[model samples]
Target chain A: MSTKHTIAVLVNDQPGVLQRVSGLFGRRGFNIESITVGQSEEAGLSRMVIVTTGDETTLEQVEKQLYKLIDVIKVINLSSKPMVARELALIKVKAEPSARPEIMGVVETFRASVVDIGTANMMVQVVGDTVKIDAMIELLKPYGIQELSRTGVTAMIRGNA
Target chain B: MSAQTPEVRSTEQLREKWLKPEVITGSEILLRSLLLEGVECVFGYPGGAVLYIYDAMYGFEDFNHVLTRHEQGAIHAADGYARASGKVGVCIATSGPGATNLVTGIATAYMDSVPLVVITGNVATTLIGTDAFQEADITGITMPITKHSYLVRDVKDLPRVIHEAFHIASTGRKGPVLIDVPKDVSAATTLFQPDDRIQLRGYNPRTVPNKLQLDKLARAIEEAERPMILAGGGVIYSGAHEGLYEFVNKSGIPITTTLLGLGAFPSGHDLWTGMPGMHGTYTSNHGIQQSDLLINIGARFDDRVTGKLDGFAPHAKIVHIDIDPAEIGKNVPTDIPIVGDVKTVLEMLNPIVPYAAKADAWRDQISKWKAEYPFRYVDSETVLKPQWVIEMLNDTTKGEAIVTTDVGQHQMWAAQYYKFNQPRSWITSGGLGTMGFGFPSAIGAQMAHPDRLVISINGDGGMQMCSQELAICAINNIPVKIVVINNQVLGMVRQWQELIYDNRYSHIDLAGSPDFVKLAEAYGVKGLRATTKEEAQRAWAEALETPGPVLVEFVVEKGENVYPMVTQGSTIDQMLMGDA
Candidate 1:
């Protein structure tokens, strides 16, 4: 089953690194769940946060394969380690005057913020594990949810600078 | 007084003993080691910087040199050889221009996951980076394409490094490895003893699947109501055809192949739904779309297969199995992921995957789709269709031949028409789509499987690109068959341009070309031609019966294109036949 795990990969930002990495997974018929890239601390290097899950052996193979690529410097499986894992979800829920207080009470319990509001619905933003987000959505379902969007898990290791 | 005169009575030596250096020059050591590692040939062109190595090659007589038309051809030839032979194919090129020319081939190999060892000569250390003639930083340029590469600064490292290169190239999700030799390094001598053991810190390859994950996968497969197996090329790479067959049979699931996965299952089998995706069989595409649980085994979900990503298999849950983890969720969302060699994963799942009767209903539905929408090629008139030529070749060979094809309509037709009963028998550039891969790959396949007949089914445009390599087959007694489908144009691209681009005729139509028969005769290979179905059958029979390499050109109808084509962004249900 798909488990959202964050892996930090360091690669030389060459012309075809993305294609090479994506092609490797594609060739093996593994679909990468999600990935995000940005400049890393090292010079001429970039860090990519890849959220993907496979069997333990396959995940190790993926790390090994990534290292085989000329541009890849390192791969760290963040999910298996003690790390900070979180995701941001923005959900719009419909509520009448009678359900507004209950919605506020649910939002306060989860420490969620009201990002936007209309006459019929209120958009709430919450950051937590997938289970927590799902729980909050389930609670809001009785009041009628309008829309939901999630920035799938983005995580990093907790450490000192 | 005689003792005092010292007439060479020594403490240790009275007779000469062979020096380790004399037992092998560095290049000779490299060549012999590669041969012992099962490299029967090297595709290359000799040049100044690597003269000593080329000369050393003469001492290793068992190793043949495939003189390619260009350095790029050498690399691609090696790529084809690796793909066809299921072994690491070696290629040698000189420095600078030769090395630079190999880049595209290396990239192609890298993209397609071919096992290749590319050896290139380097300018001497003293002249390095001085803008010397015939010098370039190949190791740097090829860094991205190779699995791993080395710049041998000293001759002593050549023997061990070459062995390691071979090991690394053929092992663990195989890809190309490069060994760059400086001119002086090849000339310098050292005690040469090739190490059989390689101790790389980070290169351990695991072949076994995680037991826990296997259990999970088994449960998923057992519970899946509409299970479909999407087998890909990795099955052949793993040599796990038997495992795949056993798992699919025991589990009683329908199997479909990607273009690269054509031979993973027996082509003519009932369970084998031809290829799936755009241009895929109706049953295969429908099977994928309607499947509740898709068991993707070593098959990449290419864009061609998934026409509109949003609408692809929308209701299906994917159980993806691959050796590489990066592929787990690269494109489609996977509900269950198993990472291990396909063969290993399949083996683990074989016992646990219950023989469910649920897939029977799905199979029955798919069979109806298959019967309703069978792949067709019309021999409506006197002109010979390329598909008929392919089917005739298949008939002549009895599906026991190693078939290689270049890129284009002929390639697609061959994929559709030919019935491959064996694994690793059908070789084509599925991922990279390189045009001139057929002839050289056929030569290599023939060399590897001497008793089996090897045939190159190529397009006219593709044939023209690598026709020069046909000289190598004639020079050496490599008995391979070349079947050129001469349609007088870049048929696939031309068809697309014609259909979608308002029939704007560009430089794609090659109206007149050198007489193919005369051309083949010039290279000392027998030439055969066919303009009709009977003539094509006779030509194929004659070519198959021929003792040595022969070129047979089937003058197919011009402007002909492959049908059942799912136009770009079109769903499988919307496939356009030729009449469209």
Candidate 2:
């Protein structure tokens, strides 16, 4: 049985460190769904969140192999824990005068913001879970989506430690 | 004291004079760092990219550089030296093909956990991404295989990089580490401050076993009716031979070793049951199959040892002790997993294990199996059996020579017949099964222990793969004896073709191979040949007594096969016992 796992890794924020991590994933044939990396609270360390699909055995092997890399400091599988995950998306949609009211209605329903407005098109910014973002994209497809960019899911444990 | 002059001078002036940094080239820093690491010998080949480093190496009396014919030979020799001497082996090569040539050797060392520090010279930093001449991204190419790799873009990082390379290569689950230095960096000048300590935050390896797990394992051992100990290469890597000996003797348990674990335990001991898995002795395979508790130390359950995954050691509750956590439950499910160094774990377990000589029936059953299915071969008057050649060599050397072998039937034969009494005496490419590893490794072993005899047991096909290394031995006057068992075929593959593929031999025969004796003579080394049993004994005696490097070609019976064979997809209990 295969399941989705969100794994967070702490690593040295050095050049080619991300390449080493992604290279290991590619070589090991782990199917990565989404990956996001950003600087952490520490000055010289970064946090990488990777969402991948694998069975129990495959996921275990992936974690072990990742730890073998010298740049990787620690890895934690956050799927089975209480954690919060979010993805941000910027979507541009063609907006004719007739479709403006419908687009605004859809945006209001999803509680998203219209960041940019032009005569022919408008850009909407959405920050939510992957499911919410996917639903917002589904509704805006009928309005002719001009362009879209997504920052992959970033996650953290939900607690005051 | 000199108050009149010191009155005018300040504290900062005195500190500046005392802490003046010594400036040196990166190449010199590399050499000095290696000297600090206690690397006495280095195997390498020079090329365009490494000219500066080689120039720096010219007058360094602290290092002895053995120039090999090819880059692969250099790496393999270093690997062999590391295995035999229990020290980190050092090798160097230039960029591009010279660096790529070391790929196989690097993977070989990586698989077997042999400690090696491999240095490669790269193109200038300005031309690194421009496809410059003699340029290749060796650090990138060897990422997955190496334990760690560093590309030195700054000369200031040279001393620290060299120190870290040696530290990583020789620590934890020891493996090869590569340092790729750009030519410009090697030529650049920097302040040389030798730092003996390494501060790697993420590279800490667990060495001590947890007391809770040790107590649990001790309880399991005491509760078991039939307990067996399986040792592997980790025992030798951790220097745990004495601890293992003490534990086994105190516990009164039967011991079976993996191929790489050959010399860790004395082969002639009363409790020794020989190697286990494919081509293992009958007693060992049967004992492992019947045991209720299987205690594995420093060995992963490799597929060759496991046979069919579900059927392997079916009844036993497995307790796997290894330093690497990744190895646990990777192949088979482990009941008690203790991640620690083998010696440390054994020392902790030695006192906790209660003395229970209560398995008399199990010992008797093992003895019965050993008697019923002993390793046997028929003698021939016209043709010499390959097994007989190994036996003769083993007898003549009295099991004292440091033995290394190439992959094939000859390797299995040596593993079966040779009785090793001490650690670091038997070296072979067990995990990767690399051909052409024998002769060069023997040369490395010889260089490590100049006073001791080193012998390489190689097959005709495997011998030809690295036969060019004969020149290294001849020129350096390395007194290593090479015995080529000429079966005229790739015996192991041919055996598979005979049994599994209905005898459709394809490119397995080496009938027109070169005359090995003549080849040895061409290299200005003594050559000997043996066609019969009496001739083999005499030839071996003569070769052993010879002054420098000697090659003895023994033309043995063709179609010889290693037996007590566990056919692929079959369990260890279902081995095919060869004709008695």
Candidate 3:
């Protein structure tokens, strides 16, 4: 019965606002799959894109509960309609001289870029949907990924109409 | 004159500062804000962190300030005052232990939707986060419990924060709001620019119900054969009882109430069918089970009311109305949800709906059930019962007393036995079910209505929770009749253990509990004890006649259980009615 939902919340950019939003989720026991916050188009507001997994009831409750918070201004379920979602990841993988060519081929195929190359290690940066970044990570796993860091999903609805 | 009196100095200062804004300390600003809001009384305890706030109240005779024995009593008293007075009650406490002590009481008020403005003094702003003495993150701690909270760092923001706290607390859904003022802020002086304007972009509450939803509800009411009205605390809170009365009488729909909704509809009305859900009347519960349309006003369908979500009102198309949108469909599925003020919505609906003579059969069936299963208890010459105590109080006061109750069997009995005909007459910790809420809140209710008789019903275990409040009651001459149902145990939990836990009673016993009679006398209040039913009646009579506060310990049936109970996960129709 549970499904993933991406909610875009616009909130006042005040001190302790992030903690208030995150703390609300923590107390309500709503598991956050992924969340990212950044400045919005408005001057005094920030947009938070949160990916959460829940059933229909949970989704409704989550949205209603978020509206109860003082700092929260607006909430939109981007995943409910046509929307664009993306995530970025930088993966550091072990690349030998011989393995570099194959790694470059994988990067080119995935449309990812090799940001930096060292003697024994190289970093690949990928920016796309979560599935795309996940696929690239899976490919780099066999080449021995040393470290990986991911910026969680951020989304907005399509066709402002 | 060597020194000008306060009145003279104030007059001179006003003349001198006529051209400019008056400057005052944050503590003074807070007090002035309360006065502007027409606050009459404040309950608090002074501490090291709140010395400045206390100093501001010293000999300041503009309003009354009650110095309670503990912070918990202070908060509950404020909550009680709010409920009975139908005005926002204010409370003050210092930081750390003082602030933490108010947590339970604050949560109690929040749960029951009592409007309260709670003020707490924190350690100096500079000393905050340094583990300073008597310091606490009260704003952070109470965030979940309170409707809103503020930790004021700047002195200039005091007026706005206090004003906003009151506005937010008293409006919309009505809940407690805390303002944690740092010691430095309270002591620091600033030019007072009082702004009554509330322009919070994200904090507006919707009061006008959507016409579409109202029309849908109207249509449902006209079409449905078995329509019923389930009123909640919001009816009393919004002062919509008169309108609700009109709606019920106009539509010819039978009405039931939640515990907090006991006083919203007159108990003696022909259309009234007692409370609904767990421990409610068989007529209301079974009637809800069969109703085709359930029109709920102001009451959230809490699990206690709904029992099993899947089994609750399976046949009914619910029309949920509340001021808070989050509560509409939070628990049970709502067919027609109207988010608005109950009073406003009822006014809008009164003229639109026609008389429903179709529900005559449904009403007749409910009346039959009510007659068949009345709230009855067996009488004994030797044994005293809690229900009898409540019934006697109802008779003795002619149901004119404002009844507040502590959580447990006695509270349920009070809700069941006491017949309230007026709104705001029944105040209890229904949401939080706080044990120590009764006595202090009774103090508050008595303070609000000096002419009305106020009775605080408590169990043995809960009596000890905040019995220290007796000092204030005696000193202030609150005249609250404190009824202690001394079965010498936690009756509700013990009953649950007896039924659900195979009689393996945990530490529900209160054998070492103090003799409540001596305890009251120690605090300079009258005390009485009753071991037999006759003695209880006599003691009740004496207490009612006595001048000041009275604590009557009525020894009740030890192993008794409140029947008509719908256990957890059970449907309302499936009640455990123990053999009478």
Candidate 4:
């Protein structure tokens, strides 16, 4: 019954606000897959998108508990609505003369762009859904991925209806 | 424009005419804010960090401050006052150890939804997070426990913070609120505005029940053949006793209460089925399990109340009405969850509920169970039974005294024996079950209502934990009757060990303790000891007659355990009726 959920929370941009929000999740035993926070359109407010995995009951509790926090203004389960979710990853792969052409072909197929090229390595930037990004990483793993940095998923509702 | 004309006057003149603001020190503003909130007394411990506030407290005619022996005692006293008087209680402590000492009491109040405004003085703003002397991050530590907390970095925000603390503490599923004031903020000066209302955007509590939900609930209650009312602390907190009484009387539904909801309805009422949970009455527990419709009011389905989660109230269609939305369906699946004040919802439903004829067969079944498995204990001529002593106390006080208790076997016994007639008459540590809460809380109840009789029923083991508060009663002449049921062991733990762990009593035997009579005498309070039933009666009479505080020690039979106990993970029906 465990499934993934994307929840967006709007909170005041004050000291210890993030700690208050995340600490509640940690205490309540919610497993956070990833979390990303940024300034919202409203002044002095921040938006946080948390990807968590839990049963339906626990996810409902998570939303109720989030609203209990003092700094939290609003909470929305992005998965319940029509939304777009994306993650950005910068993956560096070791590319020798023999593997350079193969790595380029794989990156092109995934619609990724090479941000930096080195003699021994090349850093490819990929922006896609989590599944697509994971697929790209798996495809480049045989070419020897040296290092990787990923920005957790950020989500937005789809339409203005 | 002539200078002498009224129209030529400056804009400052218009502002000053409409809003009168006086410059005052933060300490003075704090006192003024408390006065504005209608606070008459505060239980507090003074320290170096709070010297300025204490200095401002001097010669303050509006407030009466009781200095407690320890910070923990102060907070517990405040909690008791709030619980017994149905008003927001205030407590103060300095930073570091003083603030940390209140952690347990704060958590206790938080669990029980006692309204308390706890103020702690922190080190100067400059020394914060620098590990300065007597510096502690109390706000951060109490964030999860408190309904809301404020750290006043600026003196200008002191008045507003204090107002908000009181508002948050007393309103909307009431709980404790903390305000941490830095020493510098206390010493600084700011414009004191007397009537600035709080406006927190995210802090609105739902007070009115949905009309459609009420209609559904009323129809369900009318349609069900076997319906019961399970009341909790929210009944008392929302002052819904009158509404509850009216509803139950009109509908003729059998009523059962949680431990904290002891006094919400009169124990002597014909429709009362007694408390429900572990150590609850046989009829009450069995009735809940067999009922077709269970309407829970204000009480969360705590694990203790629901022994085996899957089998608890298995046949009931649950209708949970609570002020806190988070508590609804948090523990057990609820069929109808109505989030609103209990009083409001009950008032709305009282008129709408179609009165159904009394189900005689259900009542006859419950009466038969009650008669068959009544609360029982063997009376011995040689040793006094704790139950007899409690019954004697109840007989003498006529169940009118404000009774507080420490946690253990004694607490459960008191709950079973005491016949409470009104709300706020029975105050005890319910949720957290703090061991040393009785004596200090009794002091608080006594202080709140000086003319009323307040008794603290404690076990010898739990009493010793905070026995130092006895001196506060003696010094202040707060005449609170203290009764220590001396069984010479941690009775509840020993009972568990005996039943579950093969009677291997490890460190549970608390024998050869200090003579409680002598200890009370040492504190210059009257000390009485009773070894027999006649002697206990005489001692109770003497303690009641004495004007000053009295401590009565009753030596009773050891190894006495609370009965109708549901073993861990067992269903409510599977109870071990001990020694019956």
Candidate 5:
């Protein structure tokens, strides 16, 4: 029953902190499956979003464990919140000139973008839920997919401040 | 009135009563609540923004903290904890890098369906989104991996969010949850209400199995002859071992557990065929291949389980019972789909399926196959076989222990040798094939079953991935026994390489490693070295007697592979055992 969960952590911008955090997870043999770091709305502080999964008691332990780390200021379980989660994918498909229009029709239906176009290949960008992305891939398979890439899922809580 | 003169209270007492509020930092309150709720420990890293939480932790001596090498490790530790304990694991990371590091661990946990709560600190409330120094769009980064997520802009939301995270993590399908807190929120002043109350639409999880679905499932079971039971991690999650056991016993159908479902069916049970899939037992392989009806309970048809999808159980009618509706037809097509917890599903279906007492002929056929290809090690002549170590541990522990395993040959060896007589006694990373899962999983398992002996059967290669975890055990006094099968190579991959690529051993060999005994000493934990059968037995005996965390390093011969292995690109019948 080892399922992964995503977590967003807020901390001070400093050195040796990332090591400390990741080390804690590894040291516990907790799988820090994936993590993304970037600028937050707050100045001086950084936001780290993580995805991991465990049981309720274990996660409660993790929350308490995280509070003990000196560099970590606050922690959030974004998955338990009422929020919106999404991911982006860039897929390149090959189509004959004659079938180009048909491909465009499907793209328009999903509100996707034709980011790049070549004589025989078209690169389209789509952003939505994972299911939507998967559906798009399945639809484009008939048209011949050349290459595909995805920016893993990201999320934001719903409602205004 | 004159005798009883009214006395004025001291200024300090009046000030304490009238002005001094019962003060506690948000982080400390959070930690205290978690401890009160039976969270004895947590895993995480520290940062500037989260300094307040660390300070708050100083006051609560009841809670133990294991500082990970990274935030990702903290999340992973929580994952391991949750997996082993059957409860939501918790971790904390600072903003930016700290929070970001938790992403991979969270995603891993999400895919595996482990319940976890991750907490991160952000900058003060007023300075949000100013292109802050350590700030990042964490909520945005974690969307796909979590069941749900939360960002708390105010202090009042902490208790509710935490409560919700715990509930969601333990309930339903179970996955990870996150909460982002601004720095000021941790320090903000607010009335302390320890009561956790939260109400949300579209968030209710089913606690009881749907009866209609159960009826349909019973109908499916009643019609089958050559039936197969496919068990998954969900059975463990639902704690439905008794119900599942009763149903399987009454039906007299052989059980084939998945990698995640290993311990769901007691290994020692006569009806327990074995694991099914690429590396599954010949009995399980044949059972799945020949079955006319497949009853999949709480298990997904992972590629390893359904190799060469077109050829997998082509004639079987699959009846899939799961809590997640999305999983019904996601992997393999289903003839009948029942969505609910396995425990409830089995309970309701237990009565409907009449006691068709004895399938003596079918049971005899299965027993014949089981005898022909019992899960046994052919190469017992080696100097130090990992399988023997696992067998000895199993014997010594008497099936009353909780065992966690890291990925690779050692894991499979443990699975094959260890007799898990009870449910929830074995924990590992089945979905992700994640390495380094054992040490921390044992830590969490030990916490959950304080009196039970917890053992981490680890491979040299996998253990090296997070050897630092030993330090956490040492510092926190979590007395998990670590049995490292020092094969000096990545045994599973090495086996694959030998079997397929002509045995040109590449980077898989590890001729050099730190002295494990010294390594344990450095971590302030006890160490035992074993090379022979006697040494191993003696070491294990000593380990059992030890009071604190101990590492027993067995210098097993290199290139010792798990046998009775079904080679890749071959049918289940075409197995490659020792000397074959």
Candidate 6:
């Protein structure tokens, strides 16, 4: 009965509001997979994309509990309807002069870019859905990834406008 | 004549009215805001950070304040006051240690859904986060427990925030709200404006029950042959006891209340089932399991009531009506959840739903169970029983006195023996089960209703938790009676150890407790003790006759345990009974 739910939340942009939202997850014993917060289209407001894994009842509880926060204005379950979800990841792989050419080929195939390159390692940046990011990470595993940083899933409803 | 615009005319009138401006300090602003809220009495202790507010409070002649020795006592007193009277109880404390002392009390109020406006002073705004003297991040610490909180950095936001704090604390699913004011904010001067209107976009509580859900519920009640009504503290909160009585009388359904819902329905009613859940009456426990349709009002099915979650009311279809959306299905899965206040929902429900006069068989079975398993305890000529004392107290008070109890075997005995027929007459730490709540809460209840008799029942161990409040009673002449059931041990814990842990009594002994008579007299209050039934009767008579505060200790037999106990992890019907 486990489900992956993507929720989009709008809240007033105020001090400690972020803590208020995230702390509720911990206090209520809800498991949150990833959360991304940033400014929204409206001034003095912020939007958040949270990816959590729970059952059907838990998904309902999550949305209801989020609405209880004083700063939270709206809560919508994006995954329940047509929605598009994406994540950004930066992977640093150990690449010498010989491995650079092969790394370039893989990055080009995934439509990624080599953001920074040192004599020993190269940092590749990829923006895609979660599956694409995971596939790219797997391809570069043999080359030895020095570091990996992923911005958890950020989502939006598909084209109402 | 030149045409004058309406905006221009209004600006000119404002300028004329403000020719002489009146400015007040932040402490004055706080006092004025509370006055606007119609707060008459506040329980608190003054400290260095709140000294300015205390100094400003001196001129408010009508504002009564009770200074307790500890912040925990102050907050619990306010909680007790709020529960007794339908007003928001206010309490104040200082920074760091003072604010920290109120944590347990805040949690207690939070669990029981009591309305309290907690105020705390902090170091100057500049000194925040620098580990300054007597500074604590009370807002951060209390965020999880409070419905909402504010740490005021500017004095101008005082009126608005305090107003919102009171509004939020008293409205829908009422709970405690804390307002942390910096010392400098309290000392600064500001123009105080009292505004009656407030706009909070994220905080509107739904009060109207959905029509479709209500119709479905009506149909369910009409069709259900074995329906039950389980009422909780929400019944008392919404003042729907009378409505409930009228509804159940017409419906002919058996009703049971939760631990906190004891006085929401008349206990002497013919169709009344006893309290439900752990430590619940035998009829109530069995009745819930067999019910086909359960109508829950204003009560969340807590774990103590549900026992094993999967097995609780397995055959019943639950229709839960509560104001808080989060509580609808928090503990047990709820079907047909109607989000609204109990009173409003009942008003709409009473007229539309047809009475279930068809549930005659179910009602008969409940009555048979009640008669067969009535609460009974044998009288002993040699030893004084705790149950006998409670029964005597009930007989003495005629079930008219407001009773508060601490957590232990004594509290359970009180719940089992005392028959309450009115709302808000039973006040105790139902959620957090705080031990030191009895004495301070009695002080609060007495102050709220000066004419009514308030008696606080405590166990020997729990009484010692907040015994220092005896000074508060004597100093203020609050005229509240304190009764301690002295079993000379942690009776509840000892019972658990004896039944489940092979009687390996660990640290349960409290044999060295001080003499109760001397302890009360030391605080300038009359104290009396009774070791036998005859002496207990005489002492009770004398204690009630005495004018001011009195403490009576009933030294009862040790090794007594509360029964009809559904131990943890067991289903509600699987209870360990006593040979009463």
10 residues in a row with least lDDT, candidate 4 chain B:
B1-10
Question: Lowest summed lDDT over 10 consecutive residues: which window, candidate 5 chain B?
Answer: B13-22
lDDT of 5 at B471: 75
Rank the candidate models, highest DockQ first: 6, 3, 2, 4, 1, 5
Off by over 4 Å in 2: A116-122, A144-148, B1-21
Say which prediction, candidate 2 or candidate 5, comes out ahead on DockQ.
2
Give one digit per residue, the lDDT tens place, for model 4 in B329-414: 78989898899999999999999886646556777787788778778888889999999999999999999999999999999999
TM-score (C-alpha, index-matched) for candidate 5? 0.73
Root-mean-square deviation of candidate 2: 6.1
Worst 10 residues of 3 chain B by lDDT: B1-10
lDDT of 5 by residue, B31-125 (tens): 75565456757888889779888888764445567787767557767776777677778899998888898887788787778888888888787
Q: What is the C-alpha local distance difference test score of each model? A: 0.80, 0.90, 0.90, 0.89, 0.77, 0.90
Worst 10 residues of 1 chain B by lDDT: B11-20
What's the iRMSD of model 2?
Answer: 1.0
> Roughly what TM-score does model 3 have, to 2 decimal places?
0.96
Which is the leading candidate under DockQ? 6
Model 4 docking tier (incorrect/acceptable/medium/high): medium
- DockQ versus reference, model 6: 0.81
Model 6, residue B187: what's the lDDT?
A: 97
Candidate 5, residues A41-152, lDDT tens digits: the string is: 8886777777677875556556645654434777888778776767789999997789889999999999998999999999999999778999999999999999999876
Model 6 Cα lDDT, one tens digit per residue, A1-161: 99889999999998888889899999888888999999999998899999999998898888888888888999999999998899999999999989999999999999999999998999999999999999999999999999999999999988972
Residue-wise C-alpha lDDT for candidate 1, range B1-580, written one tens digit per residue: 0112334433234211211335556776776667667666788998988888898876444556777778876777787678777988889999999899888778878767788999999999788889898999887777667787888887888878888888888877778998889899888876667567876644666668778877777777677788888988889988888998898788888889888888789977777889887677878888888888888898778787777777788667888887766666767778787777887777777878777566777778877887787788667468988888888888777888889999899999898888887887888887778888787778777766878888889898988877888787788767889999999999998989888899997789777888898899999999999998888888878887889999999998887778777788766656676762
Estimate TM-scores for all models.
0.79, 0.95, 0.96, 0.95, 0.73, 0.96
Candidate with the larger TM-score of 2 and 5: 2
